[model samples]
Target: MICVGKLLGVKRRLQDMTDALSDMEAGNGNRRILAVGNEPTADLSYKMNEIVTRYEEQLSGLRAADETNRRLMTSLSHDVRTPLTTLIGYLDAAHRGVVTGKEREEYLEIARHKAHDLKDYIDVLFDWFKLNSSEFALSIERAELAELTRNNLKDWIPIFEENHLDYEIEIPERPLFAKADPDGYARILNNLVQNVIAHSRATRIKIKMKQKEKEIEICVEDNGIGIEKADLPHIFERLYKCDKGRSDQGSGLGLSIVRQMVEKMDGRITVRSEPNRVTSFTICFPVKN
Candidate 1:
């Protein structure tokens, strides 16, 4: 009679395991085999539970990736279509002689500007895609950061002057060596400065570099309508944008790209802003011997 009872218990546990596994296979991940206290199937149950947990985690990651892809598609549709439509409209008007003389010239000029804006947006989109691609790589080498920065800023001086913005640059004459991808580093600086020119409603901009005991710091400060305190923390998140009233010109990927590049190069970037007072973006790289 005791031997018969043991056989029945084993049979019952096996049936339960079979049912639970069937439920799990039918998309019920919550189904679990309960075996306790040295039961014949306890070891098998534990192993099965571990496998389910890992599978659940993988599914969760896939779901999240799908959601992100959906959001990206939606954003692309709206952002690209709106500007592209306007660009086509302007070009259509100019081509069909809808306006003539100085008005026509103005229309053409506006169309030209819109075309350039579309190109800029497309360029940013490409950069974002490239940066996120698995094949994307940086050629990091020990380079003189000061000279690279100075050379990059030289091109921006004319742009600052054209926008009627006063600028100050203070990169030390001495060479500061760091492990960096020169092109990637240049893009980081360009994005920050471009962000200021587009969004910051300030008249003065400053760029400075400092050498610390173990790190090199590059700072870009602007006396502008700074970011809202609430928005500061999310500035580096992908596709995040501040209040639309700030400016609608950006693709919202610039800072995200900057953060990725900085991290890839084994550096860090930070920002501080006080609304209506000042805004600053700082990048730090470990000093390379």
Candidate 2:
């Protein structure tokens, strides 16, 4: 009878020890309860934390995007209204005979100029939207880099002359070739040149192209007012403008467009600047294999 009692006591103690271990694993040792039994896969706290984190991140992104959309709508409205008002004013003056003969012709010309500027802005905004939305399809074919550069430069001759700027074109006699969409290349150069003419108070601008190993360097150097170091990092940021506000505040969209075009081509743009010493935009792109 004593032996049987001792065996029974030992078995009871073993079962108690197992129960304590199970409670400890459940993190209920201090106030032991088995509401959530400890078999593997008992805890859901980590997954809950991850889900909460992802939800917060998505919500923040949505809010930021909404704010940007609102700002863009406002900027667009203002830009459109200003030019439209000028157009209406010019026509109203002509209709009232306030402007006649030579004056009327001049006013019409001014209105026409405004129209052109507005058209360009609208076109850019359209393209920017398309590109941002991933709807810009690049039909990549074999492109001659030097030829494209030459053609684009030729088109800008009148602009260079109008700005009283001199260009020092540096391109190799042998054409450098790349795989790109012609329209995309045009946007890149156009944006770069416009940026110089509009922003750089420099009298002389130079466009240089050089073969750097497997990559090519196309540099637009200006001797203008030059950009401040503090503004360089944000130079390519969309809608960011410096406070200097030259009489020529420009469209304020040039450099940002340049960066976009370059990235679309899988290329990169780098810049170096000082207050007035020199500023250069170097776009390095890979050549076709």
Candidate 3:
């Protein structure tokens, strides 16, 4: 009688497990096998359920990635073609002497700017691909954070003056050391500044760095048209663009790349904004002992 009871109990639990699996197979990822306590098959049931749950999560992620790729390709096609078309028109007019003298010079100048725009777009795309690839490498090194940041921002001074932008840069005199990839750090700073210049119609910009506790912090602030509250959450998302009435001059990969680079270097970034008041991006990295 004891042996018969044990066999019946096992049979009932096996049936329950089978039904749970069937529900999962039918697209109910929430279904889980009811693990029998102290039964011979309990371990197997638990492991199998864990495997099914992981599979469901991975499948969902893959579907989301696919959707993102589809949108990326769509945006890429439109962006590349629009600039290329204008560039070709300019070049063709210049070549055929459609206009001469000042008109020709103007056409060539416009063509040059368009060419540069196309190149910038292509560069961003390449960076995105390399960043997402498995074999990408970083040359990490120990460096003074303040010095590196100063070197990076020095080049932007002339640019700011040319754009009639009032800028203030404050870096602590004391050296804050960090182990990071110099190129990656430069890219992060450049992308953030470029985003502000391209999107924000701010008259003044400020970049300041400070060391606190065991970490170093950098802030890039602009007093331009700030981002909308609804768009803040998705700003770091890949291919996400805010509906802030700015022209689509960017490939929408800048902030995404910045976040990825920061993560790769064991850092974090955050942002806060008040519409038409201020927008600031803050990045923090652990200081090397």
Candidate 4:
């Protein structure tokens, strides 16, 4: 009789496991097999539970990704379509002779600027996609950071002057060496500076580089209507943007891309802001010996 009872217990445990697994298969992730006493099925039940937990976690991740993609589509529709429509409007007016002489020239010029803006937006979108994908690659090598930074900033001087913004660059004449992809490093600087020009309504901008023992630091500081304290922490997150008052004209991916590229090159980036006083973005890379 005792032997028969033991057989019955084993049979009961098997049935319970089957039922639990069936419930799980039928979309009930919460279903779990209860392993009571020192039964032979306890180890199997524990393993199955672990498998279910992992499956649930994977499903959650997929859901989050789906949500992010949905947000991306919404943002693309608004950011791309609005400017594109305006660009088309400007071009259409110019093409159909809606204005003539100086007015017509102005319209055409505005249309050209709009076209360039659209291209810039598209380029940033492409970079964000590439950086997030598996195919993204970096060619990191030891390079003189200070000289490379000076070369990069040369192109931006005209832009700063054009915008009537005062600028100061303080890159040391001596080479500060670090391991970085030259193109990627250039983009990082470009994006940060561009972020300042596009969003910060500041009159003065400063770019500085320094070497502190084992690390090299690059700082971009501006006196603009700065970021709010609430939005400071999330600025590096993909698709995050500050309040409309501060960031009325951006695809919201520039800083995110900067952070990703910095991390990929084994570097770090940080920001600080005091509204209407000062804002700064600093990046640090390990010094390559």
What's the TM-score of every candidate structure? 0.86, 0.78, 0.91, 0.91
Would you give me the overall lDDT of model 4?
Answer: 0.91
lDDT of 3: 0.90
Top lDDT prediction, candidate number:
4
**Candidate 1 lDDT by residue in tens digits, 1-289:** 4598788998999999899889999999888889896787789889988998899889888998788678878888888898889878877887899977888888888888778777767877888999979989999999799999999999999999988999999999899999999999998999899888888978999999999998999999999888888888899987788983247557788899999999999999999998777899999998999
For each candidate, the alpha-carbon lDDT, in order, equals 0.88, 0.75, 0.90, 0.91
Question: What's the residue-level lDDT of 75 in candidate 3?
Answer: 90
User: In candidate 3, which residue pairs clash?
Assistant: none
Q: Report the lDDT of model 4 for residue 44.
A: 90
Clashing pairs in 2: 202-223, 202-224
Candidate 2: segments with Cα more than 4 A from true spot: 1-43, 245-252
Per-residue lDDT tens digits for candidate 2, residues 53-138, read: 56557767888878767776777888888888989899889889998999999998888888877887787677668767856677
Off by over 4 Å in 3: 19-28, 35-40, 245-247
> Number of clashes in model 1?
0
Least lDDT summed over 10 consecutive residues: which range in candidate 1? 243-252
Q: Write the per-residue lDDT of candidate 4 for residues 1-289, one digit (tens) a residue.
A: 4598888999999999999999999999888889965887889989989999999999998998898788889989998999899988888888899988899899989988888888878889999989979999999999899989988999999999999999999988888999899999999999999888889999999999999998999999999999999999899987788873267688788999999999999999999999999999999999998
